[model samples]
Target: MSTMRDVARVAGVSAKTVSRVMNNDRYVSDDVRARVLQAVDELQYVPNVMARSFRSGQDAAIGVAVPAVTGFFGYVVEAVERIARDRGVAMYLTCLGEDPDGEQAAVEALLARNVVGLLLAPVADDQSYLKPWRERTSMVFLDRRPRKLSAAYVVHDDNGGTRLAITHLLDHGHRRIAFAGDSITVPTTARRRTTYELTLFDGGVGMDPFLVSWGAHRVPVVPRLLALPDPPTAIFSANPSCSMPIVRQLHAAGRSEIVVLGFGDFPMADALTPPVSVVEQDPTELGNQAAQRLFRRIDEPDKRLPRQVVLPVTLVRRGCCQRARMGPAA
Candidate 1:
């Protein structure tokens, strides 16, 4: 309940002098600054950030809008928070749960908070609604780029990584390969699926349309993929959510011999029976890069034009994807 006037009274200084000390004005004498700070500590005074922002026409916090608070985006949020802390800026986080309406509401709430910038992994198919705020807020997209906005973005090379995975399987003589992922409407999923088909063509293997499965929920179709007349010798699971289910399905059916190369590396991936190999993209690095770029844009909005960065992905060799071409054991 302590106010600036209380601190000023306790420090025997004018209200303007106390305000100068609180704002770290260089003109305040050392003696006055020390007394004002001591009075602030003794009174447990908390400055109102809203009031400060209103007066200065600036906000010290950045908003982070993500699809969810779990999985790969969870790691991204953690890294963004770490960098924001290191740079002494507040991060206001919101999760949309993969819904377009929720994404719009979350972003509007952040804008209402007077956030200086936005770091978003948007779910909306179109983001043209943000055009009005574009002139006022610095924004940097994460994981996926915005469809209608020309903002800075940081994303993984999903297509290239898919090629790496399929190429590995092809090298291991897996001509009959299956692809599993989320809906093709997702930008990453579409790119990965396209790459999967292109890789098969380049390897001189015929693409099987029946082997590719995608939808809003593709986990249930995993079991069906294995039941086909000509089941795949290997499967390339594109997203993190799709990977674990396929692994479990294979284990449940005692079909662990079938090769699996997942896109995103998960925790305990190395601890599983026939540890899951993966095309690894560092979510932490991706988030850190996004936050750093956002801050740079906030500081030099006009000096630096929008930059889109795509981080590389690598394949991790593990037992699951190491199956060699051979007949079933007698």
Candidate 2:
């Protein structure tokens, strides 16, 4: 069998350099690395990944599945690519089209491809759809997490971000605050809504069940919210996707006083008339970290550490989300 020793000798480099080259780790000079790779190709030396898995396998491929190609989704995929490049791992990119069947097919497709690990932005919060491949692959979730899920995950401090947002509105002297967006079916939406309401209650405001808005999905329901006789003083939309409809309705109704803060960052959120305030999603970092964690899990599947990585995000105030037309400072 061909060996690292033979490659190291042929490339005039040490076996450790061969390993570094194999893993795509840093610290090797480009010239020496090139020679090592050339030697690998010439020797027809395929790394024994399955054997490595059994004893010393080090596969250099990861499968990354995202729900869409929007700004946030694309950012996550880019970050995964970067991390893979840095680590000498190859990334197989899949867009799941943001649905359950699509997400399932993506994971199944990756498993069939013999991908070493998976980094997923799940389409939904159920695993029965993914259980078929769960045992065969290592998976980590991004942006949204699933119920009864066993995989390690990376996500925003969603509840804390919502609390910060609601507190900002309260400080802006908004009494009739409306939580508009998110379906109870989506855990992230439900969690943020609950936190927003709790923050209001904690601040001594009675919860107005009428002021809370929700639906079965993330479709546009802004027109309904705004047309109410007693519309909200300030609005908090949890997703950037939800903000567009909110903005369009407000513009149509000539209701600029209705302040809004979006949860996920988007391109035009800053360019709009009242540059929408946003809680930076930072999915790039999330995907990168989740990939790293999944690789670590692959390397030491029985490692005695339960890993949970949380990235920090800031509430960027712009547009109407800034201090809502500040009153005279007395």
Candidate 3:
């Protein structure tokens, strides 16, 4: 209810002085700042953020766009929110689902709010559309890099992680290994799938197209994969969404012989009957680094920072990937 003008009147200072004091301007003397603070407290004055943003041409908040606020992405959101709270800034979040077509519109909606910075986990392959807004807003890509647009990004080493998982399986003597994922269109899935094939090829076991399964949360692929004449001895799940369902299906069918290695760790992974092993990627760290890069961009709009940051991943061995049992031929 109380406005800056009211505080200024009570503090016996001009509205401009009140504004400077509220913004922590160093030019205002200590006595005047104290008087303004006392008046603000007495009147319960709350500065309107929207008004301030309108006057300054940018909001004191940041925007985040992700596929969904669940699983690994949920952890990223929590981390970013923590940093935003610590910085005394607000965050606006939007879930773009799995559709790449909707990505541009959703991002534009956030930009329309005049957000000072944006942290995006983009689904679209090409992000050249964001080029026009680059001058006004600080944009940092998270988890995936932009294709056409060169910008600051923080992402996991998908190729290295996938190699680690596939090599682990190969070390355990899993020659007949399969790849399970959401969709090949996704950048992360594509990278992991490529690495999975390359690692298998390098290990002297060429890729088997029939062994790869991908769709939108479809679990029936598991049964189909098992029904093959030559079933895979191991499967490399590209993400947690694919990992959980495949693990569930295998557990229900009592197919403990088929090994599974996931790309990202999830809850209940260690509690499964044959605890799932994974190439561990820290979503919290990814989010933290991405948020930090975004703030850096906001602070130094003209300074040239590194274009990309690739964080390393580690493999967590567990009960799933065991030495292959000798088949009848062997």
Per lDDT, the best of the predicted structures is 3
Question: Alpha carbon lDDT of residue 290, candidate 2?
Answer: 81
Decoy 3 TM-score against native: 0.83
- Separate clash counts for every candidate: 0, 5, 0
Q: Rank the candidates by lDDT, best first.
A: 3, 1, 2
Between prediction 2 and prediction 3, the one with superior lDDT is 3
* Pairs that clash in candidate 3: none
lDDT of 1: 0.82
TM-score of each: 0.80, 0.77, 0.83
lDDT of every model, 2 decimals = 0.82, 0.73, 0.87
- Ordered from best to worst TM-score, the candidate numbers read 3, 1, 2
For model 3, how does the per-residue alpha-carbon lDDT over 1-330 read when each residue is reduced to its tens digit? 777799999999998898678656789999999999999999988654434455567888999999999888999999999877766679999999999999999999999998988999999988999999988788999999888998889999999999999988899898889898899879999999999999998999989999999982675678888888888888889998888888888878778778889999988899887899999999999999999788767755688899899999999988777787654212
Summarize candidate 1's per-residue lDDT along 125-228 as a digit string, tens digits: 88888889887788999999888777789999998899999999988879889988877767788889999999999999989999998851454766788678
Stretches off by above 4 angstroms in model 3 are 1-56, 326-330
